[model samples]
Structures are given as structure tokens and as C-alpha cells.
Target chain A: MPKSLVSLLIVLLSVLFATAQTKSSSAPSDLPPGSTSLIDPEDLLSELQSQQGEKPLVFNVGPSILYMQAHIPGSEYVGATSDKQGLERLRTRVKTLPRNQPIVVYCGCCPWSHCPNVRPAYNELQRMGFTNLRVLYLADNFGVDWVDKGYPTTKGQ
Target chain B: MRRIVLVIVVIAIAIAVYEAARHSSHAKGHPGAVDSPAPQFSLQDLDGKALSLANYQGKVVLLNFWATWCTPCRGEIPQFIEFQNTYGPQGLQLIGISMDDDAKPVHEFYQQFKMDYPVAIGNANLAESYGGVLGLPVTFLIGRDGRIAAKYVGATDMTALQQKIQSLLQAR
Candidate 1:
């Protein structure tokens, strides 16, 4: 066999092996630790829109512009990083949310590691036994990645 | 026809400028009483007695929004208890709005902290009336006159609360 042909075959095999390893990994990216919940943004968006006529959809954590600049349309506003008032607003809303429907939560307050808002929301939902929970790991803040992706977003709170 | 077109263009430009100015006015940092005039609410205590902001009309009130489960809120509990006891006689009333989902935890926390101040479960109407809570450990200082004197969103230092109370008291 030609030397170049043998070398090319070896390279192709290595690439295939690497791709297989990544695919079989136990973890999925964009998820925080202890997250038993996962859902796609596209799925979340569709669910959110469908529920809009029946209920106010989506919950934005933190006081970041992600809630104000652009968010899933018809979403209710709650600041995870603001003051006690903000959290109270969230609590009231949470109590009223239907457990059967999907509730998508995101926050730009912190990256996944040190996020104060998203962690609590995720844990709280689990405690409440919410079966359908979607957490969007906005790489960095929402403005840089989520909105910049040209995803559907609405202005104002 | 040419003059009418010119007039319409000028009007559109003027309308656009006005809209831009209006949008900026409601920006996050617009200031001036963003969180104040706490919502009026009446909640029954664990004992089934009712209480509301209107009940404390003549005193300087501190509507401290908190949850027993919130670590930062708990961290400030000791100081809050102390501040209330020290300043209580002087007319500073610290009203705690507990946001705990379960009353058992709230009861345990109250016992552990020995909180003398009154507490009530939070509700949406109350939250909305007080400009809505964006996060935990929110403290709103209400003056005797009924307007919101100052709003503290996070865990606040006892000293800072004292300073705010002093000025609000002096204002009278």
C-alpha cells in the first residue's frame, strides 16, 4: 500500500474515535451540576408561546437587561438579583404557576458556576415537584449569546 | 403635494424623537422612588390574628422582605432582631414579610432566631403594591408620613438601617 494512503486512513480513524468518545460522554454541556432536568430552547419557545393564551409564560431571573432588552414574549418579569421585593414577586408567581405545564427559567446574573438565581429556581422547582422544567444555560449573559442568536425576543418587562 | 410630503416627514421625525425620549425615561436606572409605597396587605399570623401596614400608621416602619430558607436573609436575622429590640422603643417597627413556602420552616427559624418582630406570609398583591420584590433580603424603610423613605434590596447592615432611620426620623 502507498505510504500516503496508509497515513490518510490512520487520520480518518482517529477522527472517528474522537467523535465517538464525545458522543458517548455521560454529561451534556450547558447544564449545571445536579441538573436532572433538561429541555431544548426551541421546544421551550414553542411551549411558551402555546401557553401564552392560557397563562403568562417564561420566568426571567435576575435584574439583567435580558428580561428587559429581550425575552420570550409574554413572559412575566421577576428579578432574581434585585431586592427582597423581586423575590417576593417571583414567589407569588411561582405559587400560581400550573405544575403540569413547562416553565423555562434563565438568568445572566452569573455564569453556571456561581449563579445565585438559576440554582435556587431550579432547586425550588424540584422541591415543588415540577415535572416539566427547562433551564436555558445562556453562555455568558443573555444579550451576548441568546438574543444575539436572533432568537425571538420581546422588548420591555 | 410637495409641501404636504415635507410636513409629514417633519412630523415623523418629531414623533420618533419623542418616542426615544419616552423609552429612556423608564430605563432601569431612572431613579426617583423606584421601590417605595409598599403595598398594603393584611396577613394572619400563625396565631390567626391579622396585621397590616395600616395598623402601624403612626410609627416609622421597616418592611423587611425575607425567607427563612434564604441564607443571606438568615445571616441578617440576628442583626434584625437586635435592631428591632434596640430601636423598638424609639418607634422603629420592623415588620418581616416571610416568603417561606412552608410555615414549619418559618416557625422553626423564628424560634431559633428569637425574632420579636411580627411576621406574615407574603402574597402577590402585597408584593405588587410594594413595587414587587426582585430578589431576597429586600428591606423597605417607611417613614411615619406613609411614603417610602428608603429601599434596601439585599442584606443590609444594621448601621446603615440606623442611619436611614435617623434621617427619616429627623425629617419630621
Candidate 2:
């Protein structure tokens, strides 16, 4: 009922509200600043389907099992970037490409917050000076975000 | 009086936001599988022992596709170990299919967690057989009759999953 008590309560409530917003938005916190390197599933699908302009080289940086089950057609499997070997393979794959080449990487192995692959791959590419890299934002996983959405996919090695 | 009302409103909004975020992160449960036959697979466990779906026939099976590197999958392991201990005698068989690229971490995880279920390294074929396991922590509940009962994707609601397992165990 006191004015001071009300002011304290308001401050506490503001902190709580701010904390909630931070936690909810933490899913993309691992991404690059501004999350400008991220691409939505729908946008990537449109780009793939349009076949207009210079086509980006799409890479699957998740597990091979998921890649074999379903993946964006024509996306090269770079293995799980969380592993040492997978990272090496990714570097090898892109070593010859121009630094400015349009590239997209995705790892729909789990939720966006939990994916252990994409961040590493994205960081590696960034360190390698790739300016045109984009990480596909699969909020859930591939099955729910892309494959289940009826996006074009092909299963195989 | 006005301050009290403002505090109440703020509290209510905070609670709403918390609940909404919690539910959104919880596993998305799929509609019950149309009683389709459970996909059969024979694989070798960490100990190189034969682990097969047929081995658990006539029992309620909780087939979980996970990987050691998967954070949500790791979160579910302890609860699953408890489930196996509590429900093993009740015809509940918890089987794990690790989708990890290697089996070494899975082996370590198995011992560290004291997992009571049979976990085998999963392959692309095995994943595809179950309608494509394109994600981590995908779970399938199979009835005693070897038919799929329910499927859950992402981090599941453990309470609801336990209840479902109980019902399935009671069915036969």
C-alpha cells in the first residue's frame, strides 16, 4: 500500500519481465550478432525452388543419419560440425571455393537452441572470411521445420 | 489500492509469459500412430550384445532415438533410466537408439548414467524405417502387440509419457 513498496514491486516486476524475454529469445543467442546470418526455412525453400540468381552452396552440418533420412535436395552432407572430423571435412570442402561464395549451412539435428553443429560450422566459416554465409533457422528440427512442411527433399548418401 | 492492482496485473502477465515459454519448449506430441506395426531392427548394443525389437515382443516398448551430443536427449536419459527401473517388471522395455556419429561417447554415457535399457548405435536405415528420425530425442511408444501407439518429438512431457506407458502396460 506504501508508495515505496509499490516502486520496489514495479522494479522487481520489470526485472522478471526482462528475464523472461531474454530466456525466450536465447534460442538464437548463439548465432551471429543481429542474426543476420540466419535464413528462414520458407525463404531458403523459395530460393532453392526459384533457381534464380547465383545458387548458394547448401551444406548439411548435422549428423549423417538425419541427412540420409531427409535433406534439402542438392545439399552436401558435411557431417556433424560439432565433431573434429566433421569440421575438418567442412574446411576441406570449402577450401577451394571463393571466400565470397554464397553458402548456406544447416543442422536440424535438434531445436535451434540445442543444435551443437550449426554454430560451430557458422563460426568456422566466419573465421574463414566467408562473407556470404547463411545458417538456415530450423526452430525445431528438419522433420518438423522443413521435411514436414512438404519442402523438397531427397533421401540418400 | 491502484498500486496493489498494478502489482497483481504485472504478476499475472509474468506468469502468463513463463507458462507460454515453458509449453513452447516442451516436446510436441504427435497424434497417436495409426496402429502401424513397429519397425523391426536388430542391432548390437554397446556391449556387443544382440539388441532386437523382436526380443521385446509382447512388451510395451519405449523406443527413443537419441545421441549423446544431443542436449535434450541427455536430459531425458536419467528419467528414462528411472522408468526402466520402475517399470521393467511391468512389461515396459525402454530401448535407446543412439544416433551419434560414434559409439565411444554413447558407451561412456551408458555407464555414467547407469542406463538400465539396451542402447544400440543407430544408422540411417534404422532411422528411416521409423518414418525418418530427422531429429534428436524422437520417442515412440509401442504396444504389447508390436503396434505403434504414440510418437513424441523434442523434449517430451515426462508425466504424460509415464501415464501413457502405464496405460499401454495395462492394456495387455
Best by TM-score: 2
In candidate 1, position A13 carries an lDDT of 95
CA lDDT of every candidate: 0.64, 0.87
DockQ of each: 0.05, 0.38
lDDT for each residue of candidate 2 in B73-107, tens digit (9 for 90 to 100): 99999999999999999999999999988888999
Which residue pairs come into collision in candidate 2?
none
lDDT per residue (tens digit) for residues A1-157 in model 2: 6887779789989999986565458556657543668888998888888857888999999998889888899999999999899999999999999999999999999998899999899889989999999999887899888877668899898
Q: Backbone clashes in each candidate structure, one number apiece? A: 14, 0
| C-alpha lDDT of residue B54 in model 1 | 91
| lDDT comparing candidate 1 with the true structure | 0.64
Q: Would you estimate the TM-scores of all the predictions?
A: 0.51, 0.82
User: What does DockQ come to for candidate 2?
Assistant: 0.38
What DockQ does candidate 1 have relative to the true complex? 0.05
How well does model 2 score by local distance difference test?
0.87
Task: Tell me, by lDDT, which candidate is best.
Answer: 2
After TM-score superposition, the amount by which residue B13's alpha carbon in candidate 1 deviates from its true location, in angstroms, is 21
